[model samples]
Target chain A: MQRDALIGEPMVRLTGVAKRYGGGVIALDTLDLDVMKGEFVALLGPSGSGKTTLLNIIAGMTPPSRGSIHIAGDDMTHLPPSKRNLGMVFQNYALLPHMSVYENVAFPLRVRKLAEKDIVKKVEAVLDLVQLGHAKKRLPRELSGGQQQRVSLARCIVYDPSLILMDEPLGALDKKLREQMQSEIKRLHKTLGTTILYVTHDQEEALSMADRIVLFHQGRIVQQASPADLYFKPRSVFAANFLGASNILSTTAVGDGIAQLKSGETIRIGSGAAVINNEPVMILVRPECLRIERYDETSHLSAANSVPGQIVSSTILGNVTNHHVLIADGHTVMAQELTRRTAHDWVPGEQVKVTWAAADTRALEPDEMDVHS
Target chain B: MKETAASASHSTWITHCANAWAWFGYAFLVLPTLVIIPMSFNSTDELAFPPDSFSLRQYEAFFLKGDWLSSTFLSFKIAIATAVLAVVIGITAAYGLARSSFPGRGAIVLFLLSPMLVPVVVVALGLYLYFATLGFSGSALPIIVGHTLVAIPFVIITASSALRHMERNIESAAMIMGASPFQVFRKVTLPLLRSGIIASALFAFLISFDEVIIAYFVGRAGFSTLPVKMFSTIQWEISPVIAAVATLLTILSTGICILVTIIMDRK
Candidate 1:
């Protein structure tokens, strides 16, 4: 939420980081990253995408095969985890089973040989911060899953580490509890002013909670940008598809700011340096950006990219209706429309027109798309 | 409804069969021990199960004999040393095997557990020959060493199982919380493994206390263990006093086993 206050020195920096297991499994490629002081960054990716490996590298749990890591202006590439002075929250909470909540939170301070009074005060403060003050005497197994996670969080913050790394910390929780913890973590970050690096496969969580998102695919970082920038201007097809629902169409550049879809329909787009005449390109349009109208109604037309298609299927998803339309070349383009009381229900096999503003469409270089199937 | 009722009756019959088999098994195993208990109280000097009269005469003989008391003390000293040595080596080996991966890990594990797999008689003979060559066959040293070797596997087994049950990330979490390696082991790993360590130590003690073949081969004159003494006594003369010692050994082992079971269940 404090997006304007991100201008500061780099708290953590990774240069040309890579990791390769003995079995030739490439967990991370040459990667460079920087985290500003007090910034909340999310590493968003699918499983096996190396987000966890990157987090572990920063935590000094796993050393990078090649490259150096600098944290708070110190070279820490070979430092052990104990000397890194970073906090981590595992997906399973990883609370000490034999210790009470209070002892679990006080473990870090005790390891530092802090004074007894200071340790007690810090433990109490963190427990209160997480709203677990009443349950400090309870064992980890005696608490609920969410409460155990809160205890893990409290333990992480009690020592006041400069950075906290979370690896899908909310993955084990249900939707409601996950959302609640997300806000709780965000509140903690705001109040503590510690830099955070979060790793998760959930796009919505990253979008809602992160100031910047670094998207990974197949051990490589695809793009790193602000949440709004990532959603609106993805640099590659993977980023476009991973961020949200996107309708992609193969097109060829015909003129300035104009491209012709395979269906022989010309559509205007915001041209970029990559757009050249007679070159093949891929156009990405968000499902929400495409508007569907009955084919017979053409009088209220505006200067926009439009295509005529036949509705293949329509799904009503409470408050929004998704229409899948097949164009002349048999390419399917999806359009999402908000449901209204007076709106017409367009059933399957109905002829319709899909339209969107030129600014809403993005043209990606054809080679940038990684065909998954 | 009829099918459901028929299936329920069928399951009940199977349960009844299983229960009958279990009771028979228990009785078969326990009948010998029960006979020994009665014979331990025999008034006559003969080793008969159905005694003509019951008395504590055999127990009195066991406690009064100088040879029996000295052998018992020697066995206690050797078993205690074996247990301590076994636990020290076993805990370190188990931790290494559980935490690290290196070349020949599987082979090393098999080697550590090879004593349990080999026939005890073979191991006893091998140990006897080796100790004879080392001039240690007549002393308590060879017996203690052999017992320690045999007990190490059990300790490793119990300790390794406990280590496996622990979540590895707990150690990583401790490390990330700024705990040194020694601190992590002492504060996190050791406390979590308390019940397991204690249980394994008890097992080692019992194994060393009850071992017969190795002790028989390695025992020297004036240093025979309790089992060796009993064996010699039975070969020369069938003493009823052996029954009393057997009953006492049974009680000690059973008490230890129950204590281990309770500790494991608590965890």
Candidate 2:
């Protein structure tokens, strides 16, 4: 994609970026990216999706095989990391083992050659922001994983660069600490107004914190959208599957915005470019979006995108109960209900009717294969 | 619990036996030097263990005498110079081997470390011939150069072992934080390997200080390290002074070895 001026400011821009390893392995295919100022963008993917590679490219830690990167209207593609002036928080903390927390936080400022008073003040402020000022004199090894991560945060932001790059910075923390840091990061982003490019395999993190998420697979981004758009209107099977658990059903186009399931059941769907009239296509629907009710075969059981299935097994998740239903065609469909009260009556071996609204499903592109839920 | 206690007692007995065996193995290593120190005090000219009589004249003669005292001083200066040169060369070479990937990198590392695997006699012979033509034969400078060459592999091996465990990203992180290459090496990499660098320095010192054949092969009529001096004194005639110097060299080298071991263990 060619670069174009977008509104008033472009915080970061990557044109035709690429990375190749020693063995001629293409780690990142040619890519382009644009991050607007004050935007919090998440590069979300499964493992080896080139998410971190993209972040590294922007951070100036790793040079791209081809093309250029620009931050704050300056081309920094060929520059060394020190000249780029970008802050990065690594997954492993990367704190200097012998330095105390305050020194780690003050490192970037020291590199900037700021005066002692300015450095001390800036460091104390960032430390206070991360709520780690009380432990300023402690070494990194003395801190817990969560506290170490906060120290890393303080270091990355203390110098106040134009941008911040985080590579799974919270992956090592416990769930509670991870959530807490996520919120703290969001609050910090709001206050700093600095552009951010975060990389993670966790889709939930992307959904919870990002202004927009770029979903990557293999070495390419399959989709880019807001969290709600990705959840409610995914245009590709991979995006739908990766964002959440999705069931892909093969279907043949019938007519009037409807398609025939392989079970010979006609299903209604929304209008989209993923399919042409009378063309074979796949529909992606999430488990929670699907509905399973007690079976009543007396009415011929004909309904739009509805199938008669037997309840095979069920599990009660905290917020929802998940049911496994074996369809007449032998496909096991997953159905989740908001409450156990609605699913309690269903017993193993009992028949049930599975259905979903057509608008909730999307036409799945063949190239965009479903991600394993 | 009662059965477990009984099993613990049996295991403790086995551990005690193993500990005794460990002491026995160490005793074999220690006995030779221990015997030599006492034998150095023998009153008679011919050196003998469980001497007929003990005296301090050996140590007195060693300190107040011949080229022996001057040679010991020369050896210390050479060892010190060798240590510094070896550490600087080894650190840079090891960093290249550990950090960079290039054509012939593996071969270069093999070449650098090969000195350790080659026989000291071969190195001594090669250096002796080279020194003769280079106009450095029988000089303390040649001895220092030769010993530094021998000591470099030890420095490289130890430094590389310590450096290999360091994440390459630490350097990158320093770079990202606006550290130049020199600053990153100094502020980040060097600080992390403090003890390892000291240990490597000590190893280099010990390597040169303990060297005998190289010094013997290249020692001029008057120029000699303590080792070469002691060697000639023992061969020319039996003397307690040589034993006194020998005990000092043993103590110094063994002390350095223990120090390096301790530092490496701490790391």
Candidate 3:
């Protein structure tokens, strides 16, 4: 998915949006975001990061206090949700409990005053698309969680809105079902080619499902890019820490693309990584990038940096084994290894060396420690 | 182990005693009302339990005698009016109090429910004095107004509870799916709340039908409700017809209560 390929009017646009509650609590600050046509953009963040609020504003359920909303080049700030010509799926799969699946799916068309024959045709097609055609006569409560979610998806797409807003629509399901629904939603998006603005706090869900991931923290977007870019080239400490497991080591820039850690270990920083003069910056090294070697073994691989440490703890997580190595007082770097590649399980208190390539380390200004942490 | 066994047996005995006490309380509350059914069919003019030769004469008197039919009609009309009025006011107030917050919301809810907490005698006396001073005495409108005040609290409680349990996102889902606010209320909110609203209406009807204190105080001679007429009859004479009327009222109330219970259970 190339940003340059999405060359048209944005499906949804927000210019300088802000939301302030009573007693001067800011839920969102001067946010400018453009969701391109037919793009699957995810708003990902922790709880209370204004991602849900932004979704509500786009859905027209909540009015932004300061900014204008435009959908498909039409001003929609003053319009209600019904007039926005958008579809939304809620976290709880907010299907009408009193209506059967057929009636629930027909609700949008009925409200639109579509012809009855056409409505039946479209609804049946959508139900079959979501593989819920057999459950049409059943009420929402009679269906399982995944089935109800499918009905909600059917209802949302039956009307064929230009943009679909999903607010953690798979959050209520178990892990297996959630993953199944994720692929189901991605398939729907590909089939329909409708722009989607998905709000989720699950980083893996966003990373796996979205074309673009917009990271939010404290009422503002910290960074927005492709999933790989966000994971590999994050601009801020918060962005790096929020997207994945990161070992942040405090370092002082020694000019050029080099920084020395507080423990006197010098590490090469990736080119184009931002470095501030005479100020402390943080080096973000992902756990997967670190390779653990016994202290006595000669380095066989070419890597830019090596740090001495002893294994303090290790976690076996099915496919991967995570070893936490303490290189200095209160500074531990996590190294992840594939379980099959390990000759034997490394015991705690074993001496080891953690190595990484220079390109894997991102130099970032030590700003914005995680509020949640 | 022996001490534990002894304590378990003691708790079992306490449970049995509690069940017996509950049954006794139920009998004490219901036996007096049960006595009126047989007396309603008494062949003799005197009101007696275990009637001396059961007959329908008391029921006939209740149906065919002085001012009884008209008073019953008046009571039905007032109860219907109260039910309708209370439902309208109560559902609106419940929605407002549930959805939005502003200064004095708690105070408003307390004031709306104050009628149920205040003594009936005090409320009746206050309305009587207020109506007397305003030259508004002796009208069906006053009785309807008084009954609505008594019924509104029940309506609000039932509707608010239903509103509380309802997922607010269901309404938002409708709104985002191209339904207007009015359509959302009509198609989503109202249909989902059908059983609850029906239960509330039934409660209001029953409350207004059985109300005696306010009807006695606010009603005039010509516009007297059924309970008001029954009260005056009991004061003046021990008529067996009063038993028949009591039996009829009891049956109507019990049937309505069963209906309400069924409706609420469905919700």
Candidate 4:
């Protein structure tokens, strides 16, 4: 739906951006990025992974040590935050305790000396948008945490800035409220069509809300992609492990397109000229993609690779039961089931045969998957 | 019941000794102050702890004497000006020290607090030599300046600590929303530091108003502040009038303390 008006042009560009803190601590190292107009892009990473550093640099709160930044095609690297004209939401929901919700929302308008009627109208509109219309007369301390967060949102958006910087905006909320606010933020973004740069360490929040996710690791942008693309086609073991659970297995190439498991069982690997014969390789398959049972029941076994293992532990996660199995090679492999029908009732120490379709197994680089296999 | 009471009670001789000591301590402290208030109304020109007759002569002389009245007015001006100056400088510096981090910041903080740590004799000696070099020794200006300098560091420490727990996110949020840096500071930071600033101002005022050591070195004739004049008058003559002035100063300082407590309570 957003492809029509805004997706064609890049609204913000960070070219070779980098930042180094005091005592030679490098937060961001030569990071390059582009955010499309009207897109909600999440800068996702663990703490100290340069996500917040990127947000601060984009907000103009801090200057990059070694790169240029442009906003809507204008060079804004040297401008202060005042000139940047962006709205930001903080994790703490920093509303003024002395001010009523109405006055806090009107703060920006008052600063600009907007006409009193216009200020009133804009503040009312934003308050209604955040669903705090009834509580506008109350002070910040009187509001609940979720209500306070909504007021913070109203205050940030009343001015209608072109960009909104949110640094872990919902991170302080409990799980249920966070999920509710995720929908609220998504709905607001749909209506506003404003460029938003969100930063957070929570991967699920990033995956759920982002039009695109820029994943950072150790001061580097390890990968950037759509959630589905990052999940299914991760380029490295780091990506696979960080995004979700993956069981990587080591195999010995027996022939062209065929591989022998360390257990001496032969299975078909996808044929490619890149697949060198008799070469050692690490094969990655997601936990849920594996179908397993205590005994082999399949008649047509050629379509799938079968491995024999003993269940070490299994956890019942409502709809799915995650089984950790130990292979004959002393490697622990994880398998997940969709329903209780397959293996939820399976106890530890049960002999099991796990199988996956050959096409589902992605061969990761040897060095990247060394830890798993 | 009789046996329980005997068991709970302390030794009779020790209890009596403790009560006697407490009463004696009370008397020792109350003896001087119990005489001054009533003796201020003495009829005689010469003074004693106990007077033969009573009148309001000393009270009348307090206002009628040109030197005392002028000295009180000059002291008021100096104390007020010094308080304002010290609070402004101290609060700004303290806010900076609290909110910002830089190299040698700890040492800088210690240096600012050094005036409070050093002995008053050393401070008085330094003030004496410094004012004498400027050829303004025994003048009211040097004494006021010295007192302001000493009072400022106290204001700075109080305000800086207040600013540290200030939830810096308020300023950041204001900036994010469309307020300029100055607007954020004026509206958010200032209101939050109001209690600290008022406390600092009152404290600085009292510090300078009652100061004696530096004033002794720097105060001169024709411009003697109230405390300096009181000190000199007490040296030349220990009269009931000085005691009356001392009692008034005590009342004024007590009023300031009460005012500070009320303002802080409002916060």
lDDT of 1: 0.90
Q: Give the 10-residue window scoring lowest on summed lDDT in candidate 4 chain B.
A: B135-144
Ranking by TM-score: 1, 3, 2, 4
Pairs clashing within candidate 1: none
Docking class of 1: high
DockQ head-to-head 2 vs 4, winner: 2
Task: Score candidate 2 by lDDT.
Answer: 0.83
Q: Can you write out model 2's per-residue Cα lDDT over B1-267, one digit (the tens) per residue? A: 999999999999999999999999999998887888888788777778788898887888888866678988888898899999999999988887888889999889889988888998999999889888878644578788889989999999889988988877778888888888888898999988888889999988888888898888776766788888777777878777777777887888789888888987875
User: Residues A1-373, candidate 2, lDDT per residue (tens digit)?
Assistant: 1113335567988888888888988888887778888889999999998888888888777778898999999999888889988888888899988799999888888777899999888888989999997999999989999899889888888877788999999998889989999999999999988788899899899999998888888887777778887787776767777888878777888776677777787777764544577888878778987787768743332343677889998888788888889886678879888875544567999988887776666776765353331
User: Candidate 2, which CAPRI tier?
Assistant: medium
Q: For candidate 4, lDDT tens digit of each residue in A1-373? A: 2333444667788999999888999888887788888889888877888898888888888789999988888898998787777889999999998899999999989988999999999999999999999999999989888888889888878888878899999988999999999999999999988788999988899889998888888788877888887787766656777788898777887776677778788766553223578888667789987877656566354588887888898887888778898877778988887665643477788888888888777765543332332
Off by over 4 Å in 4: A1-6, A250-261, A265-281, A299-302, A341-344, A365-373, B1-66, B136-139, B265-267
Please provide, for model 4 over B1-267, each residue's C-alpha lDDT reduced to its tens digit, 9 standing for 90 to 100.
988777657567678899999999999997776567767778777667678788887877777874888888878877888899999889888878876889999999998898899987798889878878888744468877888888988898778778877898888778767678789889999988988899889989998888888877777658777888887888887766876676678778889999888876776
Measured over the true interface residues after superposition, the C-alpha RMSD of each candidate is: 0.6, 1.0, 0.5, 1.2
Q: Candidate 1 residues A133-153, lDDT tens each?
A: 999999999999899999999
Off by over 4 Å in 1: A1-5, A271-273, A299-301, A366-373, B1-19, B137-139
lDDT score for residue A341 of model 2: 56
